[model samples]
Target: MYERARYWFDNTLARGVTALIGWLAVACLAVVIPVSALLVWTDERAPDTAWAKTAAVWRSVGQTLRLGGEVGSPLRVILSVLLALMALFYVSTIVGLITTAITEELIALRRGHSTVLESGHTVLLGWSDQIFTVVAELVAANANQPRSAIAILADRDVTEMEEELRSEVGDTGRTRVICRNGRPTDPAALTRVSPATADVVLVLPRDHPQEDAEIVKNLLALRTAVDDSRVRTVAVVRDAHCRLAAELAAGPDAVVLEIDDVTARLVAQCVRQPGLSVVYQELLDFAGDEFYVVDAPDQAGRVFAEVLRACPTSSVVGVAGMDGTLRLNPPATSVLSQGDRLVVIAQDDDTTVTTHEPAAFDESVMANRPPAAARPERVLLLGWNRRARHIVRHLSGHVAAGSVLHVVAHGSESLAAEVRAAAQAAPALTVTFGPGDPTLPGTVNEVDLSAHDGVIVLGPDHGPGQASPDDRTLVTLLLLRDRERTSGVPVRVVTEMTDDRNRVLAPAGAGADFIVSGKLVGLLMAQISQNWHLAALFGELLAPQGNAIHLKPAGDYVRPGHRASFATIVEAASRRGECALGYRTRGIARAGNDHEVRINPAKAEVRYWGADDEVIVMAER
Candidate 1:
């Protein structure tokens, strides 16, 4: 009975302020009334009559409880008690109002209910693993601008978003990151971030396939929230089928990048050239040489051949005419008339200066030997996943006829059917699927490592499961590396990982390449977010139908043991209808050296051309 009473009392105390006040008053009265009566009775000169003594005890209790205790007639005592009660009621009401006001204000702050009044800010909608990189890149891009701000609106808690961004992105420096709590798909909720007034709004995509529809809805909600059609918007969609819907909702000015197409293109390119991802990382980031459109008035009447050497600190890749059409690696005779912008690759916009002095080179040391013709190739794939079909199709498009791709994975009927469909889609190449577990040593060692030109290792989708996708990929990499060590064989290996931490933990060697799923998308989004023109530039660059970045033999341009300036290599490539960006040294990519890949070298910088060195260029082949 006592425990039950205590439990009931505890529940009542938790009810609210009214219950707490009632309990407090009962506690005070139980002790104060009895003590007051005892004091009055103990006094000798208290009251002679019984009625007088009772009234005196009541007066003492009233005075002790801070109610008015009048030592007069009954009417006077009753009026004083009434006045005291009114005063207590007024004070308690005022106190309750103030406490409520403070509590509501705190809750409003915690919920991020206030509207942002800043103009020309960047607005981000939705949340994903890409947020950290996007925020970090925004911080870097806004480092020079004063009082720049990035407002993020999502369904996550404001505090959680702030703390995670701080922990992942480190110091944001001058750029302020404001987080708001709301669903991005709701137009009413989207208004809190002021997307209409924002300079650019980015709609981030999540990992789930169903979230693609939500992203499209976000774009549509943005349409309802922002009346202005001029506001620039960038969105990402995982499925290619959803790209058209997202783009239509985003309007003509928006840029919608399909992640699957881009990922497939990158993986296909890396499979052929192990060192290509390194070049792309430098291109897509702000820290290194990237595409820039700058005026070249000085090269007005010069042919595109001479314009190649017009900049000492930059590489001229193409031109953008007044009509806004991009021309990458045009004919050698193409003229760079005044008013046409030069699409050059440089470390910064200011560095694309025209050099009046011509660069000197040793034409005597130039090699006239053309590159060997292309031949049929073979590829060995160790695993399969959602990206495998796209990889196979894009790889088939890049390789010559009679090329072969051998896939080894689980031989389940459903898996076999998927591989068979992908194989049937690529008519020019032959694809064979072998059933086995790639992580086992015998499965990898059974293949002839010397016959295949390259090997691709892909893991399953990353999430909660028996084991992580990264763990399986790393196991295969270790087995491949071990095979190379024991059998004295060398093979180019391209690995796909789901996590950045595990990507770094994977073993690295001369013929190994690592591609992180989210990191690449984050970098691409950041690049396009900073400069919208890059959207078209990257679109054309990654497409298989146009000119692409290629790493070619330095011996094909400049003979081995011959010294030449970068300008001479540029001229050599210009003769072949290509633009030479930079060169990579052989075996000089040790510590402190970034894999020996250098971009945007000065035109006058001379070096001894080695046979093993490769010249980076934009060419059709």
Candidate 2:
């Protein structure tokens, strides 16, 4: 009965009840006057004396005022009329608002663009920084289809959602975004966005502890709401151990992306190649060229070098097979089957070619030399974070044996031991934990960073309610630069930045590279949002299997008086079985100038040669 009453209230009575109630109120008022007059006449004829009659008239006048009039005399009658008019005005305004809302909803329904209490659309559960990124990607992915809609259901104000979208992502193009205000975990609230007809559901982890558990609960609710096995469901989980629980809750076909593993991998890559996160940025962002599947002509058992030279339009980075297996920059001699497709970097399908060279590199000019001599190392790890362990682990991989890692921080007991164990496990790196304020005096000097070859500052975690990490990073950079000027030591500093806002804060002369964590996640979601295969491609690049970004010595590509050309560098790197994509120059001595790390270098710059240019190379493992 309650359900039926609600249905009637929503469907039928909700529209016309206001007007009916207004008319009924008017009728009640119209009948009250006659009834009051009859009663007063009857009372006066039956028993009232002069004083009693006067008291009875006053009583009737008071009753009239209470009903809708003024308190005294004939002016009360005018007051009553005025009160009725005011009530009518209020009723009209309320009725108009309800009517407008209902009308808008009806029109939207008729156009098949919206629905109430759930219907066909992709429902994004929860709210976080990843929400905007998720929406933008979903829109772009479904852009080619006609009238594909995305419903965002979160425990946030719908108007705030709209405003955030406009400010962050302008012109959603052809995709329509509908915001539903409610908790995503509640079944009734979830119904507001219609989960039954949803093509896919993405349950994002909240930015809090027990986020993994929250995802599991949301998944369980989603399963109950939609029994359809065909609907693709994806969730984000914080811990590796929780991944199994989330996957079990989401079922076999559903994907539960483990946040820690992905983040760790990114941090590891950044440690190896300081600006690798930028590659992810350009690939994931909509403004630049993205990864693509371009068909390379029958290489006829040719080498990867020849195949790379063969692809004219797109920049070939990897290849995908019919069996869904992928290989990044597979060896030149690796046979290409007819079913295999080359993965290239291009803006779109139309912007690519099958067989052509990306400006020829003169082979004669290519110079291959022995590796540079090792220098004594001083490394400073400023601050502490979740990724700090992973960074230390990967950093230990490349350094010479017996190299010292000075960890300077207001050390936490839990993280301190973890860092110590990780570094001890590494064969080459010797770990030392020290207590010092990153933004304080005598802290950097006490560590003797002047003797250090490089310093790495780990950004703070965005976990739970932690303070913003950017300011600490900026202060550390400032302190380092001030000390470097006094000491005159060229200490290579690589730092982690949590927010993009702090990018300009560090002086370029601080001799450091910055890694923005949130931006990396944003870029990842953006890529997978547009093309599903990109997730796999990104995984391959980030993984330790092949052609990872490496910083090779400058002597491998250019000499002291050589005319600079990207083609020459590419040829040199190719001779070493690597792809030379870009370089970071050691030429910028003054702080705050361009750090001179160009990823996709222009082919025509003749005066850009430098002996200290670190070649960005991609090679088979």
Candidate 3:
């Protein structure tokens, strides 16, 4: 019996303090009511009347009930004191319970329990380091709208995500960003963001080994949860082989980008032609001129060349068919069918207007076109990384048969083996590797830098026992610049930087072309998020088999040192089965100046072209 009583006491005390207080209040009430009733019955304040005893008992009970009201006897006073103590205990217990409940609810709120009621907002379905860039771009894109919102759903702490966004993207202008904690692949979690009502969905690939698989699963989940076909979806898949699976899961209406393929093609193009990445960045990012699809009913039956002359503010680059076909720089004689859209490059979507007045063309200065030269190239590659193999393979596709590529890196044997494996698919060009550290001046001097036609510097991948990747790249760039200054060699240098901020710190006179990986991906994703049709457009432009952007000699189209109108240049390029977009003049190309490489210059304006000036064109070869 004693052991049972002890167990009962321990269990009762182990109950929460609030529960103990609740039990104490009940016990106090039980004792206080009976004690007050007994004191009322034995009160000696009765008068010599028939109802005098009943009245005295009632008065005693009332005094005790009022929590220590005026008492007439010693017994009544003691009961009142006990009743007051009980009331204090009851009030304290109620306050404690209320405080505990409030704390728990606050914690739940911090964990993201509230549901979003926003409609027509952009929804970001995953999280990574690229989120900052994506958010900043979206904010700028939505700056003119009075009310814009971006909701992020990720499997992370809500408060932490908010704090990181606040630190990275300070002011959002009129845009509001909301964060929720949930697994993107879970259907139940997706409902919290109201995907059915969203304007668009962007699935960011997570930073993990199984990132592609996770992205496919998330895309499937989003497809299953939303029934609206009007809402557009964009996703990124890292592996090329997994792109088919992701596309199948996302359906035909969705856009799925292959990260490796795009990056490889971009690096290949940039390495071959310097300043190409800058043009791509301007086209992809919203801060500058971007591609927009606009209806041109007035020119439905007009030829493609006429459409180019009609748009003064915008540059007509391509045509988008109603059947979802994108033709960039198609044949000039191709007729624009009814219901077709013109893919034009403009500062804003609303700024793509067609002017009725046509600019006069100078047919007198137009000259016969010359055949493209097939000169052998001697290229030098500094350092090695994961993208080096892709760069080499793509470079092989663009160079002549007798061109040679020399690779200088730390692990020469391993890099050579990898290059050999990559080159087996394309055996036209020869590749060789040498052992040396390109960042050191002595090692750089050993290799004859003046002999190469172009130099491509790759950022270090591992950075083991060395500075950061960007720091190492900067050192190599400085060394190469010094070499060029000493030798007076005019070798074009193309560099890869992991961070975008480091691009600003590079030497000004070096004339190096910077390709920032993260920022480039972020810009592409942002552009596609706004318009899903751009995915296929960019894919076709970057693919090796389709029409690609090229910088050819301006002398090929017009006479050297002769003044010719831009319209005459366009007409000349059309004769060669190509489309002329812009030109880069000799001694005029700068790092950050966009006008130095002018795109969509006035057709009537006559300008003298130098012998070494390059004309930017879109061609299949």
lDDT of 2 by residue, 1-621 (tens): 999987765664446878567666677757765666567777636445755555455456446644453434667766776786787689889999999999998765443333454455677888877776677766765666777787888877777788898887688887888887777777767776777777667777666536678888888887777666455676777666688888888886466666655665655555445555555555566665667776655654556666665554345667788787878766655777877777766766557665444456655555667666665455778888766666666656655667777788876687778777777776677888887788787786677776566677765667566777777778888887878788887656676665565687675353346666555555565555445566677666666465566677667776745666665676566666666556677657444533455555444444555666677676754
Candidate 1 structure quality by residue, lDDT tens digits, 175-204:
999999999999898899998888889888
lDDT values for all models: 0.85, 0.66, 0.78
Which segments of model 3 are wrong by more than 4 Å?
1-102, 208-210, 227-231, 412-414, 460-468, 507-509, 560-565, 585-595, 602-608
Which candidate order results from sorting by TM-score in descending order?
Answer: 1, 3, 2
For candidate 3, report its TM-score: 0.82
Assess every candidate by TM-score.
Answer: 0.87, 0.73, 0.82
Over all chains combined, what TM-score does candidate 1 have? 0.87
Per-residue lDDT of model 3, residues 83-103, tens digit only: 876986798799999999999
Pick by TM-score: 2 or 3, better one? 3
Residue 84, model 2: lDDT of 66
- Give the backbone clash total of model 1: 0
- Locate the minimum summed-lDDT window of 10 residues in model 2: 109-118
Top of the candidates by lDDT: 1
Pick by lDDT: 1 or 2, better one: 1
